[model samples]
Target: MDYSQLRFVVEIVETGSISKAASNLFISQPNLSNQIANLEKILGKNIFYRSNRGVTLTSYGVEVYSYAKALVEQYAMVEKKLMTRSNENKIKIASFGSEVINSQFFEICKRYNENNYEFNLCECGVEAAIQKVNMRDCDVALIIYSDFQQNKLGQLLTAQELELKNLFQGQLKIHVSQKYPLSKKSNITRKDLEGLFHVKKAYLFEGMFSLDYELQFLGIPENQKTILANGNKTYNDALHNLPSFAIEIDWKCNKALPSDLNRIPYENKNLPITCGLVKRKNEFLKEELSFFVEKLIDAYG
Candidate 1:
């Protein structure tokens, strides 16, 4: 039935007379009476007992008034919830490193948002980031190049199942702790590192695994090389205790080294490394994720 009629019934009961209710509603009393008559017809029950004493509601009218008022309130509440959720979907983004993002990326997302889009941001490691895509937990995954490309590293991307999109590539160099007696050398030859205690930074999961495999190509025996702790804590401590090198993009290569920690070229010419971004083969890509990747490519390409 018409919700307006429900309101009319409620107003008439409050004002104690159709004439008073019509004045409050700014509607003609005749029009108000017709609406009440229509509502009673739809409900198949008489709602009011009419007389010079104004109107009193029957039992059925009381029940409908309670339910109708509740229904109108709930309907308004549902509309509000839907509006909030719609606003949130404008943009959704998940990325690995802070350095990975650039201005072009932000500009793209900003434009989308200006055009009325919602966004969600998730910061995670390369491997975990990709899982967000596979599980559909996120619309797009911004992952590290090494983690995205190397299957044995952690979770392997199915080239056929998901599109592998490239973003940018950069070089990671071998560094040394300055405290080491040999730290003074701007460049260390492969022979100079043959017997020194050595460490390398790697991820806790697939990054370490792939680094282990790649080291074999460097002729470093498994027993000779140490996988430094995954994150910054382990990276700093390992550098303090032993001769280790961190391999990261060139930008990160310029940070101030520990007083004794020296940045040096790898003694070996054949240090195997490559870093970039990736996405699923055929999945519908997220606009923000795409924008972020494009920015990375434009900056580092």
Candidate 2:
């Protein structure tokens, strides 16, 4: 019924604890608890399942959170529209990649800020960022498809009510460490990948998906290859631990390569990655949001 209640729910989901959300919101824990209780009473559903580790959204909670997020976003939009009329508007957006997080996206935002606009930016993982856009939590979502799965990416696009406008295609290659035995060979064969330990990004489910096909192509026995899923840490940490090879596309990989890492070019191969801006349906899009997406593609292309 109120903005603070909706915000309290969102903050709870974000921080994963009532205490932390209360601390961040600069409110009392008991007050926050009472607000949530009142919200639950109105909604007739439990928004969070509590545990020792933290809180998890129940199925009902997920549904409520999605709608609540959309309502909050629309409220922000109303505020922005009012401020824009008064020449005090600020654009709030979120992205899902390291490059975007490291200020790669600023060019587009800066270009659009010609009206002396303020911008609020947040960065998160690919899936999570998409979710935010889908729920109308942010104005736009930009994601990269470094790894692909059968219908998985497509599903996300459709399920999230997003459209992917392809910016450019980049090459994906298998890379190895210079110390590895394969480093001596100019190129590796499909048969050479057996008994290799594969280092994968634990956070990215797609990392495992990409490796499945690569392994199949290499004729490597599934059981022999060890796929280790790691957390938020980069793949560089797993380099020495396992004889790992990851797929990297040309555009993204060129800047991403480390001096010590040797890139075995998948060479004129079809490992192209397509990066783009994702937005909700046409009805949800506004003029500034459309211009923002256009500028992103233009800046990179």
Which candidate has the top score in lDDT?
Answer: 2
For model 1, residues 98-213, the per-residue Cα lDDT tens digits are 33363444666676766446556666666666677677666665554543336643346663244455554444345566666666776666666665555544442353334444
For candidate 2, list the clashing residue pairs, or say none.
171-249, 171-250, 172-248, 202-230
For candidate 1, what is the lDDT? 0.60
lDDT of 2 by residue, 223-295 (tens): 5454554442456656655776654334543333234555565433455456666677785666666666665
105: Cα error in model 1, Å:
6.5
Q: After superposing candidate 2 on the true structure, give the runs of residues whose Cα lies further than 4 Å from its correct spot.
A: 1-103, 106-127, 144-156, 178-186, 206-233, 240-242, 252-259, 266-269, 283-301
The Cα local distance difference test for each model comes to 0.60, 0.64
For all predictions, the C-alpha RMSD in Å is 12.6, 10.7
User: What's each prediction's TM-score?
Assistant: 0.48, 0.50
Q: Pick the candidate with the highest TM-score.
A: 2
